[model samples]
Target: MSKKVAVLVAGSWGTALASVLAANELDVVMWTRSEEQATEINTQHTNTRYLPGAELSPRIRATSDMEAAVADAAAVLIVAPSSAMRAVTHQFKPFYTPDMLIIHATKGFETESLKRMSTVISEELECEEGQIVVLSGPSHAEEVVKRCPTTVVVASLDKTSAEAVQGLFMNAYFRVYTNRDMLGVELAGAFKNIIALGAGMSDGLQFGDNAKAALLTRGLAEITRIGVEMGANPLTFSGLAGIGDLVVTATSQHSRNWRAGSMLGQGQKLDDVLQSMGMVVEGIRTTQAAYFISQKYGVQMPIADQLYHVLFQNRQPRDAVEALMGRDPKTEMEVMKLETWEQWHS
Candidate 1:
């Protein structure tokens, strides 16, 4: 018999992953926080609220009981939003075992402690670093659930574990790459959303493609800066987790950060935009956390700082852009310092 795969959370990303696992003939059980979503997935085989018109596989079971979902599962994938990740991990603490492969599909960090989702999972679940894996990239739940062509990276400090996750998720249309730099993967995943928020602000300001292009390039610099400082491989940022994810997220109309940024750019209130998203826009909280981390680590993250003001300080998006543009110009790599090959290794 195929291994039972327990996918936690019923959000769009969670449902989409459950669909993928079920299609691969794994016995998939999805734990939803809402009974309505559970009923929809189990009875209707649809996640109408999040991914409208997408059909989920009937093999995927839905439940609210944490223990029932994780029991006897071969692998457990945590797909809850970053904000809820801590609570979700606590709920699963009783069932956690070292033998089960744990994969976190969340892409952001905790706002309070600025802890990465996988970090929070490892600490809360009482597992070692090698026991956790992060699967991230340009994957949009709306597209992946529909089997649209997509690619992502499965990263862990343990190469074997990363490969294990890569093998399970890889298919013809959805390709998976493996990386050993868990720190880089998570940082890229969390920081790209900050850039997407900036991109959304530019779009909201009715700025042309040129402005958006500059933001993306500079944002990559900002992302790489903090990532390398935090002991991540600099090259990882240039891969699927970095530029690839940033391109898809910042430009895609489906991105929640972009949508929220657009509203902010148009002078709308943060609360109103957030209320409309319904689901947590990971970038909003991440912006604050990353902003704090950047300052604490002395990493130059102008984009994150600007977005933090826009989201938290009620700064006008247009004014924030002007402030960035008005800053002193310097060599591009001045902040990144990724010039010499030895600097990367050191």
Candidate 2:
């Protein structure tokens, strides 16, 4: 029999990834909270709410029972929303085996604890931090399901674990790269959502391409600065998980963070915008966590600062833009201090 893989949750990203695993000829069992969704995938092979018109593979099956979904599986992929990651992992703990390849594709931090998804999962699963692999990058589920050629990176402190995940998900349409800098990969993936939200807000406010370009560039510097402070490799920010994910999330119509930001920029209240989207806007919650993270690490994240004000403090989006533009002048490469630059090059 072929190796079986379990995907927790049937969200768009999860479903899309399950399709990839099924395409790679692995038997995929997805665990969902909704029995309706499980039946839809098993019967109709459609998840209209998430994937819309895309038809899932016959090899992909879903169940509401966590034990059934993970029983005898070779690997289990946790794709629950960051907010629900802890609960979802706890639910699967009874069924998880140490030898199973554990991987997660969720992006965002625990708002209260400000823990990355991997940290939260490792704590709940009682596994070594290095054993958990994080898969992230610029890939969008809509495109990935349609086989539009998506590239993503999987990172783990253990090279063998990362490579195992890469092998499990790699195929013609979906490409996976392995990175050992798991901290950098997870940080870049989570932080980029904040910038993407800002980008969408800029466009919604009619700031045009130039403003968006500046935001992307400066936003990246802010990300790199804070990431380095938190002990991530600076170069990781320039790779697939950083700049690559940033561009896609900031610009793509499929991006929930960008859409939420656009709505906010158009003068819609946060509550109303979220109600209309009906999806977990990871960036909004991430912005909250990033704000506290910046403070904890004593890093200057001007863009995130302004965004927090706009988002929570009810500062007008236009006024926030003006505030960002009107900050006291400083050198462009301030984020890369002289000492840090030399150390990086050396």
Candidate 3:
């Protein structure tokens, strides 16, 4: 018999990942707050609201009850949005054990706390932060559910934990790599959304390929700048979590961040764009966090700054573009290195 693997919240990504685990022949149980949705998954075998045309594996199941979902699971994967990370993790805590492997696939920081998702999970679970493994990379949930050739990196300070997760998720169509740079992987995954939003804005503005290309290049520099400032290895930014995730999110039509930015560029209000998206636009919240993070850390994030103004201050997207294009002159290469970041700075 396959061990049960519990996934929290059957959103698109969560549902997609549940499918992957089911394909691997694990008894996948997904936790959802919606009883109707659970019934739909159990009976119809489709999540039409999210992945419209995709057929889910029979091994996948859904429930509205949280404890019931994790009761007999050998491993638990949390895929809640960043906004609900704390609350959802708090709910998952009573069932947590040091022996059960815990992994999170959420991308983005806690806007209220400016902490990474892993940090929030650890604090709630009362486990060493290193015990948590973060799964991230260029893989899109849409593609992964299709059993498409998808690759991702799993990072943890615990080598054994990383390798264990690598084994659990790896298969022919789904390739997994292990990275020891936990901080870099998480930061790269979250920060790239800001850039992807900007890329979509550039495209929405009809700024042409040259403009989008420049945005991606400089956006990476800024992401690496802050990632290193937060004690991440600079080399990690060159890997899948960094450059690879950045490229895919910034360019793909599947990216909500890109779609949100495109709507903003098309002159729609942020509130309306979000309502239209009808799903979580991570970059919007992430941009809010990044703006403050850059300020708190004393690092310069020109692109993020402009986006903040555009997003919150009602600065026009074109004006944001102009502000970026009209920055002060300096040496083209300014390095970001934390001379030993004491601890994950609050």
lDDT of each: 0.88, 0.94, 0.91
Please name the candidate that would achieve the greatest lDDT relative to the true structure: 2
> Candidate 3 clashing pairs?
none
What residue pairs are clashing in model 2?
Answer: none
Q: Worst lDDT window (10 residues) for model 3?
A: 337-346
**Segments in model 1 whose C-alpha atoms lie over 4 Å from true places:** 338-341
Candidate 1 lDDT, 151-263, residue by residue in tens: 99999989888888887888877899999889999999999999999999899899999999999999998888888888788899899999999999999899998988888
**Poorly placed runs, candidate 3 (over 4 Å):** 338-346
Backbone clashes for every candidate come to 0, 0, 0
> After superposition on all CA atoms, how large is the RMSD of candidate 3?
2.8
Task: Point out where model 2 deviates above 4 Å.
Answer: 337-344
Candidate 3 at 102: error in angstroms?
Answer: 0.5
- Tens digits of per-residue lDDT for model 3, 1-346: 2389999989999998888888788899999989999999999999988888989998999999888899868789999999999999998888877788899999999999899999999999999989999999997778988888988999999999999888888888988999999999999999999999999999999999999999998999898889888889887888999999999999989999999999999999999999999999899889999999999999999999999999999999999999999999866577565343333342
Candidate 2, position 30, lDDT = 97
